[model samples]
Each structure stands twice: as structure tokens, then as C-alpha cells.
Target chain A: MPDKRCTEDEVVAELADGMTIGIGGWGSRRKPMSLVRAVARSSLRDLEVVSYGGPDVGLLCATGKVRRVVYAFCSLDSIALEPHFRRARQDGTVETFELDEGMMLLGLQAAAWRVPFLPTRVGLGSDVLEHQRDRIRTVRSPYDDGEELVAVPALPLDVALVHLHRADAAGNGQYLNVDPYFDDLFCRAAARTFLSVERVCPTEELASNGPLQSMLISRLWVDGVVEAPFGAHFTECVPDYPRDEEFQRAYAAAARDDEAWAAWRARYLDCGGHDAYRDAAGLR
Target chain B: MSGPAASVGPGPATRADHCVVALAECFRGDGEILANPIGTVPMIAGRLARASFEPDLVMTDGEARLVAGPVPVGVEAPDVIVEAWNPYRTMFDVVWSGRRHVVMGASQLDPFGNHNFAFIGDRRRPRAQLLGFRGAPGNTVNHATTYWVPDHSPRVFVPAVDVVCGIGTDRARALGPSGRFFELRAVVTNLGVLDTSGPDGRLRLRAVHPGVAPEDVQAATGFLLPMVDDLEVTRPPSAAERVLLARIDPLGLREREVRTS
Candidate 1:
């Protein structure tokens, strides 16, 4: 087995400027914040981020790292609108490819399965056809000549980042929570996969303790595994911690003001990695 | 009816409570359906509805688990009864099967009940990127859908949406039989409740909030709303509904979203 265990820096080093990155998490839940922070701090620019967005999108947008964002939603769950993403959009800082949640999934699915395009009826009458007309096309079904479907093209990604509850040294991920989001699809779709977990346990522990169905990602797919305890900070990694609402609120408030965000970023995110963030935020 | 006056309408509850009650009322007749409320206020309404009269309404724990009882919003409850495991994929199954009823937020809602929370300005190069059309298209086309707008203004209640996330009466009609399952149920705003009625099936004044007048709703709306001859005042929560809402939302977080002023 290839030694998948590596440092967070090694994972970030794999990324380059202007790459199409698929981030796994549903909005503010189980986001790979460690990798996200690494990217934010890096010199990487003009990156295209694909995510069921949360703070990761906001952070990248706020830092001017992202050239385009493809998302179903960008709200911070309870906070409603992700302030940074909203501001970025309103200010015309970043471009976006808006897809219906299902269509977004289909796009990932097409890439994962190595298909050119997948047909769907989701965005038939809606303006998604109007907006993403370049990427999507109206096609008549072969089975029934008159039956029309939307051909959603594949969103081939350069890298995929995901945070899970736990993983083994070989990178077999275990999500003890309710949903796995689209981590598996993301891993399959991306050229490279970086798996960050709250803890890295022995392979035997993963077999004995983890739920059979929640074991979404196989080690064969994971290129690197970085042990990032509390990695999905501010976002909920269920069975670990609830979402840090106070910090999320503070982040939102700070996002409204450049000075406040600067001070907040300097004190927390700019300090160091996850441990430094923890210490600075008085987390532990 | 000699009872505690505080238990029912005209009670000490804020406008938020009344707004929640109105939103909950939208799901009153909807029995044994999946209540997928995307935002905080809508989630409150769904949970409140489930806890009260609409007992059979199923709710996701905002993660993936289907809960047997109402789990408080944003609070991590320790002993939540996990009735079933509802993964993200299974959610799509529920959506496709016409089994779910979602109460979604709207950045812009038109006279035909079309909603947009996706993008603003030109389609090719949008001036602003809102949420990508997240499940709104499928949800509106698949099953029943209701909208909740915290701020009722001419901006939200627009003449035409910049982007159509959810199909309205006009588009549904254009689709003919393919749009058979489309049910744009109601629009619950801070000011009042709007629904489709009359011969044309356009947005109509269902009921105005207690302090809100018909003229107030008309003035706030960018498009002309067909008002009912006998416009009823939105009902305040009954004693039972109030008690249920209190249990679901003990922190009174609903008030913060729906302003009394």
C-alpha cells in the first residue's frame, strides 16, 4: 500500500493555480477547512472551486483565490447568506456557474463515471437552461424521439478535498454522521483526492468501529491522508462537535467590514495552521 | 371559553410567532409528507407544523437522519430519536417520488409565483451570484412547494424574476402535462400570506398579517396582486399551536429572524 499519510502542507502543495477543485461538504457541514485555509494562505490564484458551499467558498472568494465558483448553495446554514460570497457576488469579484443541486450532482456523476454528459429532466423549464446554456444542452431522448432531456456535461476536477469523522492510515474514510454529502462522488471525479479527517486511527479500528454504509471512500481512491483533528472547525463534523455558531457569527460580522475581517484574519487564520487557529480562538 | 389569555391569539408572543404560525398554517392540509425547510424560519415552521396538527410530517435533522420528534434548531440535542437514516442520495429519491414539500426562501418572487434566489443582472455575466438553483427546480416540479420571505418589499415581490429557480403557474401551464406534479402552494411573507387563486391562477392576497393592511401589501408588491373580496386576517397561533411552537423553539430564535417592527 502506498503510504497515504502526509502532512497538510504536502496536500496543499499538490494544488496549483487555476485548477478546478471540488470541495466535499454540504454547505457548512464537514468541510475540509484545514486544506481550505492552506489554499487561502497560499499564493494560488484564479482557482475554480466547486462545492456545496459554506465558509470555504467565502474564504476563497474573500481572499481573491477563486476565479469562478460552481455551487448549489453558499449559505452558512443558520446564517442564511455566506457574507463573503454574497459580497463577492454583489461586488462582481468572482464568476459563478449556478446549477440546481441535482444537476450539480449529475455533473459530478458524469465525471466520476467518465461519461461525456448525463441526461436529466431537472432543469427543463427553469432558467438554469438559460443561464448554463453553454455547458448544458437540450437533447431529444433516443428511446422516445420527442422526449427532451437536459444534457448536463461532466465537471472534471483537478483536485478534491474532503473532511470526514475518521480515517485509517491507508486513507479509508469513515463518516459516522447522518450523511456523507457527495465526498465519494467528488473523490471519483477528481484527478487527485486529499482526505483530511478528525483523527487517523489503525485500519483494524476502522473495520471494527465504523458503520458499514458510512464508509464512503476507499483507500484506493485517496491520494493523501492528513490527520486534522478539529479540521472542519466552524463547520459541523457530527459525532465530533456541533457547528461553532459564535465563531460563524463573528466571521459573518467581520466579513461585513474590511478592518474587522483583517483583524479577525490576522488573529485567527493568518496565525498558523489548525492548531494555531484553535489556540488563538481559545478553542483548546 | 374561560382559559389563560396568554395561551392563544393576541398573546404576548412577538410578530415572529405570528409569522411562524402563518407559515405553519400553509402545511396544515399536507399530511404524511416530507417537510424540507431550507432556512431557519422555514425549518421552524416545518417542525412546528410537525409537532402540532401535522403529526405525520417527516423532518430531516438538518444533517441526514430522520427524527421521530422535533429536534430544536441549531442546538445539538443528545437523545434525538433516529427513526431512519436519510442520506443525501435518499433525499433525491424522496424529491423525485413527489413525496416532499419544501418551504424555500426567495430573493425574488414574481406575480406568477416564480421565484429567484440564484443570480441577478444579466444571465451571461451576472452582476451578483446568489445561491445556485439548489433543488428549487426539482422541488417545484416534483412535489409541493411554498415560499417564505422575511422582508416583503417591491424588490422581492418583483414583476419578473431575473432567474427562475422554481417554475410558477405560467411556466407550469406552458409545460402542459409534463408539469402535472408542480404545486406552487403559497407565499408566506412577513407582511402576509400569498397564494394562487381566481380564474387566471395568479398570485392573490390570501390573508394579511394582523397589523398589515391590504394597501400595505399592494404597495410593497411590485406586481399587482389579485385581492380576495373578503380578505381574512391571518390567524394567530391557537393555544395548542403556541404550546407546540414553544417546545420546538424554546430559545425564541424565531423572533430574531422575523422582526416585530
Candidate 2:
């Protein structure tokens, strides 16, 4: 078990170019923005980012750090299209992939389960098949007597960047809300995993009161843990804290105005590290 | 079904059955429901209600637990596969894949119409792994695919996808587009409906929702959007539709607020 604390850079240092990286967040909620920025600063190129939905992936796309993306849901739930994704599609800058929310989980589950793939009727007859032709193969099962099944191949990753509510030096992380299914399995299935949390404490503390005690992150599966607060601000995690609706409104208002957007990016995103920007913005 | 989607409304000149299905509605369909995109369920319910199809739709969760009628039956934990003859089978197989039009959502939709709901990216550390590209690839080739964007923004739409979850027009063409099933049928939103025609398909505005202007739809979109001669407002829920929606969803979905305005 790791007994020492690593800096943010140390946590993300292992990433290399053309790496397939899974990010943390759900519709901007519970996302680890600190880690996303850390990846942004890194020399990694052609990073393949997979996420459920949020601005973190958008930020990667916006910065041109992302070469391609695998997503189930993107956008802040249709408030508007993500700018980078839209521009890329219109401009053909990056490659994109789409999936349904549950199917994403099952694909991961196939990897976690150590199965080559799981056959499902999820996309039995849609456009999803044409693109996933490589990943999905149709094999006739003898048991089913010539029944055609869509098999999704095993998807293993190099690293998983998971953000959480709390963790310790040993990497036992806890979530505040949104039980956040699949993230744990995702981390466990990866070769290396980095965790960003709001606090790192004794695992016992998390076990003491949290509704979910059995789902704590084990030490062996996590390599690093960085504490992050208000990490999912523009993309918010509820109850512990609400999404910054005001920020969303501001972003929405400014995103459409090029000058306003440029100014906003310069003020917040241009400065580099979260601390400098946070300090400048009067945050922690 | 052949005429414009707008002229087929409920007043007098319309057949009652046509009046119901004519208005685009979500038929709570749970048999093949994918859990993420997290909003498709409510969306379907909302659209169905808006169309005034007040029939107690079949559900995996709800009031009577039957299709289009009320009973005191609580939802039992029965295996969906075990109950292959489920009332919802028709919803996913026939309705979404049938000749009817549908507006579903996805995490990633690719050019080939192959979608992924399997893993977000690494699958190892998915922030939120939705139901693996559930029925997107299959459904697209079967129905009029109108992708809904509860979260439409730049980062989500990409040039080349890390994983192909569903096939798009380009991919459909690459796969040799003999039929219209393989391409994205449309894109529905709080703002409007996006559809297209011809080889170099441009996402066009088919219809705008109530309170949402044509310009608002234009303001929200980020692609080469096409506008129809005139757009119609998405129909809202009626009294009977609301009652059925309530009966089927009860508290399970009623209180959930819409992410979009």
C-alpha cells in the first residue's frame, strides 16, 4: 500500500501520448476538474477521453488535447452543444464515438469480468452496429441454435482518473452522493488508476456513517489520490454542493459571444494551474 | 404518417388513434431502457404525455404495472429476459425499431451508426457508464433516429470517436446506405427537432418546441443547421395524458425536474 502522498503532477505523470484515458464526472457533476487540468498541462498527446457527460471532456476538446472521445452522453444535458465537439464535427478536427449509458457500463463490465465480451440485444438493429463493427462480432451460439448475438470485445485501459468525495493515503476513496456506479469497477479493471478527492482520511471514517460502506476503493487498485474541493463546480455534484447554476448561466451567456468567451477563457483557463486561477478568482 | 407532423393534430378532422400517435410522444418503454443519458426515460414519458397518449403505458416501474390500464399490481422483480413476452418488447422492438419515429439519446454516436453504452472511455474509470450503447446501433437502422440532447455542447460531439457507439450518416453511407435505417433520423431538443435529407446531409430544423423560437434553436445549435419553411411547436401534455403519465410513473418520475428549460 502507498503510505506517502504524491503531488498532482506526480499523479498524472504516468500518462503518455495516444493514451486511452477514462475521466471522472457525470453531466459535470462529481467530475474531478483538478485532475482534468493536470492532464491538460501534461505533455500527453492524442488522449482518448471517455466520459458520461460534462465540460471536463469539453475542456480537453477545447484545448485540443483530445484526439478522440468515447461517450454515452455529452453536453450539459442539451443546454447547448459542447463548442469543441461541435466545431470538431463541423471542422473534422477530432474523432468521436457514441454509446448509450447502460451499454457503456456493460462493456466495462465485460472487461472487469475478464470475459472476452458479453452478448446483448442492446443495439440489435441500429446504426450503433456499423461503427462498432470491430468491437462487436456476430457469432452463432450453439446453445441458442443459430441465434445471432452481438459480442462486444474486452476493453481494458491504461489508466482511470476517478474523482471522489474522500480518500486516504492508502487510496480508499468514498463518494458523497450519486453512488456513481461503474467507476469503481472501471478503476479496478484498469492497469493504473488515479483518484482525486475532496479529502483523504482514515477509511474507517467513511465506513462510520456513509450509506455505502461496502463500495470503498481498495488500496491496491488506486495509485494516487489528490484532494479537490469544488472540483465539480461548473459541473456540480448535488447535496454536498449544488451545481453553480450562476456559472452555468454565465457560461451559457458568454459561450455564444466570441469576445466574451475569449475573455472568460483567458481569465480562468489561460493561467494554467487550478491554484493560480483559483487564487485569481478568489477561490481556494 | 405521410403528411406533415403538424397538420395531424387533435380537434375534429383527425382520427382519435392518429391524434394520439401523430403527436410525437414517448411510448416509459422500460423493457429495453438504457439507464444513462439518465434522462431518456422521463423524456419519453414527457413526450408521450405531450402527445396526449394517456394510455397507461407498460412499465418496469409504476401504478398498475400493466399496459394502458390501472390495476393494484405492484411491480414484481421478474427477469425481463425471462418474461420475453413483456409488453415493453413491442415498445423497443416494434415501436423504436418499427416504422414509427423515435427520439433517443446516447453518450457517443459514430458515423457508422454503431454506438457504445459499454464503457465511457476506459471503461475502467468511467465517470458515469451508461447502459452500453444499449440499442442505439440496432435501433438506428430500424427506426427514424432522432437523437435527444439533454446535454448538447461542444465536447460531446466529436470528429472521430474513441469508441463507435452508434452509426451516423457518414458511417451509414460507408456501410452502403441502401435504406434510411442506418443514419441519425433527427435530433430533438428543448429547442427543436433536427433532421436532414440528400447525400451531404445538413442537420435541419424540422420543428421547434413551444416557447422556443426558431432563432433560439439556431442560437443553441452548433452545426450547419437547416431550417424548414416553418417550424411547429412540440405539443404539451393534456389532462388525460397527464393522468396516465401520473398513473404509470407516480412519484418515480413525476417530481424529477427537467435539466433543460
Candidate 3:
């Protein structure tokens, strides 16, 4: 069986400065942390990160690698707000393109389907349209004289990084968690996709497992595959492992305190590869 | 179960318990709707509602999985049977279809139920940037929305929300048929429960929590709350309901959020 398996660093090497990157996962769940760590370690600058918003957003913001962020919401889930992201917003360190969650999905969907825009009823009467006037447009519905809807434009990405439960070396991926999230759309919307999975089993093993619905991203959409067990640590990746709560607490706590963050990063993030960090953090 | 401090009576119940019970009551007649409780306290209420009377109500484990039983907050909940995969995208499908009933926090809420969580002050250069209109805008127009305010203060129950995230009664009425399904169901706070059941569709004092005076609620609210001649006290959790609350929240996280003080 032909394998496209490379490394986390090789996945990061495909990315460049000032490119739009989409990250897969709901807030704080199934994030490609190993790849994100790789990006953070590299001196990539001015990257525009598109995510449902999790620690990926927080890490990029803390590292000052992000020039702009296009997101619906950014949080540490249980923590509600990502402290670093919040600090970035308060200080105006990064430009933001905040959309309604639905609109954000539509933007990705539009890109995935090769459409210029997608009509939505989401931000019709809210301040979202007021704030994001440059990006969103309103057009009269073709069916009726006075009916109107918001037109959310496509958010094409230079690269998309995703983490899933299992995949084959061919880049065929499956999500064991309840929701596949927008991982499929993220892959389709991007020019290239790099997937990091917990395990790379035989193709037949994945095929025999069960429901076809669980197989989210097909090999065609993926440009590369890396097997990174515990890739989404500190974030929940169900059926494999829950989030590392103790580590998450430390991360969030460090994010709030400058000196604490410096020391913590020195130990985990600044050490070496994901292995060194995982070892220091005592991750199995 | 071991605590002699815990009791069955409404008087003995803590303020957080009252809030959990009151928040849970919002789903009483909802009948098989998606109960999306956003925050910690609200999650407790949603799960308590499911495990108790509203058994048919669908609930996510708050991360992703739609579980058969209400999993305790912040726990892995291993071996729990997953009913369905209601991910972020599918969640929007439920929202757009007006099937989800959400209980989320509000930075400010007007008398007509216009809520804000976006920002304060001017739109362009906000004095403070809160969570940008995440889903509140779509949520308000699409389905039943109940708000929770842990602390009742004039700043929160504002005369006018600087930014409109959720569709208030005033705005919904102006939209006519398009906003027909919009329902600002209830406003549950630490103080009491409020609703827009009055003739004018302004927030009315539905029920006060035990030991909370009607005047205290009024003083805290920025707008006038139409009071009934005889205000009812929010019902406390039953003995069985308390048992389920304990099971649903083994760590007593709800108590920390609601606060007995």
C-alpha cells in the first residue's frame, strides 16, 4: 500500500507567511495541535488563521504569528474564552473578521463548492452585518420584491490542517467523535490539506470498521498525511481520549500570566518537537 | 447524599439550586426540542431537565456527542451511549430550523428581551470587545431563546443594549411574519425569573426565587418589570430532582457558579 506519510514539520513547511489557513475542530476539540505546535515553533509571520477557534487560535495569537483572524468564536470550551485571544483583541494586536457561526460555515461551504458566495438568513438584522459590512453584502431575493438575505462570501484557504481519529497512509480519514465538524469542508476549501491522525491502520481495517458516514475526508482532498497519536492533546478527541484537563488548566492559567506563560512555554512548547513537549508534560 | 446540610425544602435550597431548578423549568412544556445550555450553570439545568421530567429533550455532552444519558459536566463520561452525532454544522441545521432552545448569558438585556453579548459602547471602536455576534443573532430569530444572568445588576438589565445580538420582542414585532417563530422565552437570573407575558410584551416578573424580594429584582432591573398582584416563588427542585442533579453534577459545580452568598 502506497503511503503519503511524512512528518509534522513537513506539513508545516507547506505553509508560508501571510497565507489564509483553515483549522478543523469545534472550539477546543480535535485540533491538529502537533501541526499547530510545528507552526508556532517556525518563524511563520502574518498568517491569517481561520478556525472554529480553539487553542490553535490562542497559540498563534500568543506567538504573534497571526496578522488577522477570521473566526465565529474562539474559546477554550470549558473556559469560555481563550485568555490569549482575548488579550490580543483587547490590545488590538491582530485584525479580526468575526462572522456568525452559520455564516462562517457558509463561507467555507461556498469555497468548497467553488462558489463566489452563499446566501444566508443568519446575520440579517444583527450587528454582524453592521461590523463586517466590507465582507458581507445584501441582495434582494429573486423570488420576492422586498425579500432580502445576507451574502456570505467564500473563504478560500491556502492550507487546511486537520486531526482525526484514524486514517490510512493514503490519507483516507475517519472521525470517531460524534460530529465530523467542518473537517470535510475545511479540506475541500483549501488549496492543499494536511491531516494528522492518531493511527494509520490498513485500508481494509478502516473499511471494515463500520458506518460510511464516519469517514469524513477522502484521500483525494488530502495532500499529506502524518500519524500523530495524541495530536489533539489538551483538546478532546473522543473514543481515543478526552481532553487533558490538568494540562488545559495549566495552559489557560499560563495564558493569563505573562511570566507563567514564559516558563511554561520554555518547558513544553520551546523544548523540541512534540515528543519532547509531550514527554515533559508527561502525556502518554 | 452524605451531607446533612442538603435538604428537600425550598428554604434550605441554595440560590444556585433555585437557579438550576428555575432554568430547568423553562423547558417544562418544550417537548422533544434541542436544549442547548451554553454555560456551566445552564448545562446543569439542561441535563437536570433531561434526566427529570423532559426526558424526550435532546442534549449534547457539550463537546459534541448527543448522549443517551446526561453526562456530568467537565468529565470524560466514558462508555456513555451516543444517540447521534450533532456536530457544529448539524447544530446550525437545528438552529436554522428553529428546533433548538438555548439558554445563554447576556451582557445586557432590555425590557423587550433584546440581548447583547457582542460589545459595549460604539460599534466601530468599542469600549470593550466581547464575543462578537457569534450565534446570538441567528439564534434569536430562529428559535426559542432563554437568557441567564448570574448577577442581576442595572448594567446588565440595561435600558438599551449597545449591540443587538438576540432579537428582542420589539424588533421581532417590527419584522412581522419573518420573526413569527422568534420567542424570547424567559430571563432567569440569580434574583428571579422574568418573561414578556404582560399585555405590552415587556419583561414581567414571573417568579422570584425564595428569600429574594420583588423590590430587589425591580431595583436591579434597568427597565420596569410588570409585577403580578401575587408574585409566585420559583419552585425548588423535588427530592427526586435533587437526586438527579447530584448525579448529573457529581462535583457540585453548579453550587460554585450559583453561589450560596
Best by DockQ: 1
- DockQ of all models, two decimals each: 0.54, 0.14, 0.50
Every model's TM-score? 0.89, 0.60, 0.89
Segments in model 2 whose C-alpha atoms lie over 4 Å from true places: A78-80, A132-135, A213-216, A249-262, A281-284, B1-135, B138-261
Candidate 1 vs candidate 2, lDDT winner: 1
TM-score of chain A of each: 0.98, 0.90, 0.97
Q: Each candidate: fraction of true contacts kept?
A: 0.65, 0.24, 0.49
lDDT tens per residue, model 3, B11-92 = 5778888999999999988888899998889998999898888999998876566888867775567878888877777889
Which lDDT value does model 1 have at A166? 86
Candidate 3 residue runs with Cα over 4 Å from true position: A1-3, A144-146, B1-5, B9-14, B47-55, B68-82, B119-130, B197-200, B223-230, B237-253
Proportion of native contacts present in model 2:
0.24
Which whole-number lDDT from 0 to 100 does residue A152 have in model 2?
59
Candidate 1 residues lying further than 4 Å off, grouped into runs, are A269-284, B1-21, B38-41, B51-53, B70-79, B119-130, B209-212, B236-239, B249-261
What is the DockQ score, from 0 to 1, of model 2?
A: 0.14
